[model samples]
Target: MSSNIRIIRICQQCGNEFEARKTTSKTCSDNCAKKAYKARQRSTNVQTSAEQTLQIKLKPIEDIKAQEFLTVNESAMLIRISRRSLYRLNERGELPFVKLNRRTVIRRSDIDRLFDRPAELMEKSRPEPVALADCYTMKEIREKYDISEKALYELIHRHEIPKQYSSIYAYVPKYRIDQLLSNPSNLS
Candidate 1:
């Protein structure tokens, strides 16, 4: 006995014509409200399921396990490195590989060995530089040292880094950068 007045209105929950007892009434009955709520939950669940399926399909390539032999592309994907890097490794005789017809295949064992090696050992295995002076550019030194242009200029002025001027570009000596990199504590 909430009210005797019958206000004609549409049930918002079910989109049907119904007589509402009050002006603020949305659904014709409590059952229709519950039905609408259940429908919303079902739609949300379906959307979530579709999103999860898409995520699964776009998962990172590193999740794949290594096999006995892998193509150049597959090896790059598994290692999470560029194919050009793998090709360079193969060219330098650093990473042993096999040629199967026209395709280049890398052994899983070799990839494992490469991954398992210590970073220091791996770095040492690379070819020696032609000269220490040719190591880093001015921009590289600034970035690696995390110093501003003004600070870099100050350092260059104080340390007197033997720079080679080429039109608008100035190249910093690699030995000086190597010194700072090797002894980060020396930077003031």
Candidate 2:
């Protein structure tokens, strides 16, 4: 029995028919290939134009609703912090909020106001730094504190310390460490 299977070809542009050496071939000639390419480009242009029109029509509705009251999670997302951190801020009288029944609500205007304030405002609002001679390395902190990296991470994760995201890991502020060291009661 013969092993070769028959192949079919269809012109992509003018719909002319011909035989092909392989099943994957779609055009009868280079002219048909160029024509098919042009047709594809035209379809892409039409799609992009339609999408732009739709976006233009919808943008005003989105803009008008942008300042609506936000949920705690939404406020957290907007501020790039966790919900727990936001709650902490609220508890500390740092973040303005409204208590709606059992739920906490924040206004978009308030969030914008919070962010619009200068960096000095936040610095002034934060707890005063404790005097410490040396900055502790992660290894030193782990060993001296008798805590694992995971435990240290837990403090940062819970927002007990001011932390910044480094390229590979989170770095705790030195003052936070000092505060923890100063408070013997916090050891557990």
Candidate 3:
């Protein structure tokens, strides 16, 4: 369509003002039009990338289950965590993967197997903490072992022995205390 109507319009890309012959004209000149077209293409490309990323994050595992092999990026997106975390798991020898070029692919089956042995991750049923009655008071540990309070405390700290503190006395497990302080000659 041709028109004699001249309208001042702002270029979408450069924001320059110029007279346009047609109402549909968005840019001032051929250069501005090219720039605007390129800008629009870039915007669409960005939007597409963002949409793909969201889709990857939101996609269900069932949808991806058919695939046997996945790249680090795909596996990370599938697991809904960062690639760094997956890499850490690999470093810790918890998550197994096939290295094709130093770092290549992870098996979907390996991931499934990792989750299958959930017991590895589950906390073992804690045996209830021994009652203070079953444990010797810290004073008793010091006196029985013929050690000073400071030495006894240092030993406990160094050995990472479990102990409980009450209002007046700290209690050490009987077995732990006996194991450390018991004399074999005395037993014999």
Candidate 4:
């Protein structure tokens, strides 16, 4: 059940004439086939790279910048913020927007005006370090409260007791430990 039909084709890679039984044949030898496959892979990769460059990175910035008003998604993309955060800003009335026929439109000028007069932020000063003499070591806390070192650490961690480490020794303010452990209700 074989028809004696021979198809003549040119190698897609090296331009050599070849005889094949199938019309889909493109290359004369295995070497030509490998070369053709590599060329096609390279072409596909170059095309994919070009498509990514054209669509994802460069084109959006140009299109977004050209518009006077932007949607929530476009505004978030332009500012490099999350859509949820932008929506929260709108909810807080921090970022103003206009509604036109059920469309949430943010003006470009409004977005630019956000940093016009930046709020004066003040930094809080750190508290003075507690003197090591005024604090109780882990051994002292354990001896005074009749508790194990492990239990002392767990208590300090659970109550967020400000314990400072100095080299090999850890210290907790005597007053803080006294206030925390002195409370009978805390034990309950």
Candidate No. with top TM-score: 3
The TM-score of candidate 1 is: 0.36
My TM-score estimates for the predictions, one after another, are 0.36, 0.33, 0.48, 0.34
lDDT of 1 by residue, 39-140 (tens): 889999999999987875475565545368887877887887898788656644457768789777888789888879899987876544434358566788
Clashing residue pairs in candidate 1 are none
Q: How accurate is candidate 1 locally (lDDT)?
A: 0.71
What local lDDT does model 3 show for residue 18?
82
TM-score of model 3 vs. true structure: 0.48
lDDT of 2 by residue, 19-92 (tens): 66656778877788788899999999999999987875455534534857877866776666898888766644
Alpha carbon lDDT of each predicted model: 0.71, 0.66, 0.73, 0.75
Report the candidate with higher lDDT, 2 versus 4. 4
Q: In model 3, which regions exceed 4 Å deviation?
A: 1-10, 14-17, 21-24, 77-81, 99-103, 115-188
* Residue runs of model 4 more than 4 Å from their true location after superposition: 1-58, 121-188
Per-residue alpha-carbon lDDT of candidate 4 for residues 72-177, written as tens digits (9 for 90 to 100): 8778888899987786555334567688999989998787775564454211222346999989988997787777665666577566565566887768889888
lDDT, candidate 3, 67-185, per-residue tens:
89888888887777898888656643457768787767999988777677657343342234788888998777767777777567656655556556577566778888798777543
| lDDT order of candidates, top first | 4, 3, 1, 2
